[model samples]
Target: MSRTPEAPSAPPVDGARTTDSTGPDLAAPARRSRLVAVDAARGLALIGMIAVHILPVYDPETFEPTLQWTLFGGRAAALFALLAGLSLAFSSGGRTPHRGRALTATRAGLVVRALLIASAGLAINQVMPSPAPALGILVYYGAFFLLAVPLLGLRRRTLAGGVVVFAVLGPVLVHVLGPVLPEAAAVNPTVGSVLADPGAALAQVLLTGTYPAVPYLSYLCAGLVLGRTDLHDVAVRVRITLVGTVLALGAWFAYWVLVLQAGGYAQLTQHTPWLSEDQINEILVWGPSRDLPTSTWWWLLTSGPHSNTPVTLIMDLGTGLAVLGLFLLVARPNWLWTTLGAMGGRTLTLYSAHLLALAMTVHYDRPALWFAVHVAVAAAFAVLWQRWCGQGPLERGITAAVRGTRRLVLGAPSRTAASPRS
Candidate 1:
């Protein structure tokens, strides 16, 4: 089954002042508005992920990819990852990176957050083991957070460079190392599996798993660059939208030229004799089988969803950026966007609940009905909770824990506030 990206942190509060003890307050009025837009975009990502999880990807009769499959697929996960990076950037110091003791505290807090999220994922994995209905992304998200720690201090240009390097090299590394590494013990690895063979578990999360952190760094770095920009400017938002559209189209064009136009598909058939032409096509439409066949280098040129090829990475990144830019452009202080922002703010809690609900319920029988039910319930809960309570229940707890960690590290009253819509 295809996997969707899980939510990360809660959206940061608006107009919260950051002191020296905390970080600098990056959320001015315009910045606050930008964050609300970010929340709306994240809300869309959350809804898209739910649709992917619940709805059919392929039409049963035709075996053709469904509309939901085409729209969500890997793109929703990419958006989640990009937003995660943006969240980190905002929390640390939007536009200006945190330094000294503040930086240390922020990193420490992030580590704590990573561990908590991973632990939750591990516990969930025990219930939803291999061949589970939905694969939990929380564990891999932990690794993503940990990997991002070192790069948090970097500026936009350097991070942008990192995006290119990771996009190109991550897949190459996977191709080289995938053949030698032991196959992952389970699709959704548990704590027991990790304890049994740490190396295999590490290998899976880093390289061989469905959502490997190495290749995903491209999305994170791209988001970091976006976070550093002056997002309040209309010119900046327009440029982002234009550049993102061009990048997405360009990547798709390159893939078409390289794979279909060139002899890349033929090369694939020649190399992987086990898979028939139809089977290969299925893999293209439905994503990889077990893992992408490393039988030929030509596989790198194909840009299927979750293929993690350079082209796929670039394309997904562009799409994610474009979505964010458009949301930012259209953001207004209105009821609709505010409600969406509220839902976005509670994603961590909501996504976790969603996974649990999937585990307990039989959603496949009537996926459309179930999808609607889940969205409506989640929306209602988010709206009510935002009205009654400021932060989400789980988000509030995580924030408290993160704040405590920061205080422990700084050995003082830590004033570093959470980033808006982070």
Candidate 2:
């Protein structure tokens, strides 16, 4: 929103944000079909992810709470997935494309893009050691985009119904099909290293067993459905976010409680009623399966099983909604949305920056202080982007690459640089 650019786009790895519980009010996703809250969540998520990734850059051995592999670790990416879903639905041309036309063409284009992005993720992980990202969000997101188009045409109620049914039966679907999926195994680096060939990361991305595949698509589809809601008004957006924030968090806590309290309440009941009563809870219990018939808890927590998964549904979804509340509380201040929103807008660029930062991390011999500094720095860069340039550099690049070609066909001039004083 600021017409004037602030400073350079790089963060000093040595800088640190005191984790002030009191940052400015932020934007909510529902407000922007672009899903402002979702973007804010992603911006925050990626920042946290970068911090954790760089934490190794700062401190190679001692992991920070932000980087911990518990329920917390998984939260950021889930937010990314859900927002991807929302973006897919939001970006759809209001109506689903008929059997032909650009929609058909877009589908083909998306597949290619997905592979392209997945390849990039693989290359980054293969090169970097500590933050070796096995299950990249873009790979799964591409798969989700393919599924989302058709669902957009489904009646809203049908969409909602399907989401619930699939979620309920998620455990069963995974049980039968998960073994073949790559991401499931990639869920943990321990298993991922066996199959991961950074050189062949793209192939692994396509593997049925890869992370961000089936069950992950479910989250994207759900987001697409949510995006269908015409909550454009600030008031309506606030109300929906307020309600969703409550439900998502409530469900998350409830899931945690059920898992913990099941000690006496018909052990393995979460699985018994679904996966098979005879299925032993331990192996059956295997990490929090966000798959079919695994457990209701999966939907609340993540689209995947928990393996020291840091980011939980509560954090991803909650932070998104709460950030929105903060924005509304501040009467939708421009800077509030633009800053966090900048990361979302420049997702691919920032994503690449993150990888580049990680490469720097590995190259720097895993310094903890530098990593934290970058986390803060990445965010500061985002603010700079919003103020200096309106659209994200990465988003701009991808849009140009994808749309520029089309524009050339129409005899339109190609636009490369974004406005500095955007």
Give one digit per residue, the lDDT tens place, for model 2 in 1-422.
00000101111011112334676323233234334545665666666555434333112254222233332344555556656655655454432422334455445444544555555554555555553432344544455555555665565577666655544444345454444544433432222453554423332333233343444544555565656664445675677568657755675565566544534235446434654543334222233333333343333333223321112333344544444444434433356656675665666776666665645434355455665666566668777877788666655555555454433434443364433445
Residue-by-residue lDDT tens digits, candidate 1, 1-422: 56877666544532334346566654466766787888888898889889989999988898888998898888988889998988888888877778999899999999988888888888888887336878778899889999999888998889999999999999999999999998878888689889988999999988888889999999899888887787878999999899889989999999898889887889999999999999898777777966888999888888778888888889989998899999989988688888788778888888888888888768979999999998999889998998899788878888889999998988854355444443
Evaluate all candidate structures by whole-model CA lDDT and list the values in order: 0.85, 0.46
Off by over 4 Å in 2: 1-38, 54-72, 94-102, 130-135, 180-210, 264-331, 360-368, 385-390, 404-422
- Best-fitting candidate, scored by TM-score: 1
Q: Candidate 1 at residue 208, lDDT?
A: 85
Query: Distance from true position, residue 199, model 1, in Å?
Result: 1.1
Per-candidate total of colliding backbone pairs? 3, 49
How well does candidate 2 match the true structure in TM-score terms?
A: 0.63
lDDT of 1: 0.85
Provide the TM-score for each candidate, comma-separated: 0.93, 0.63
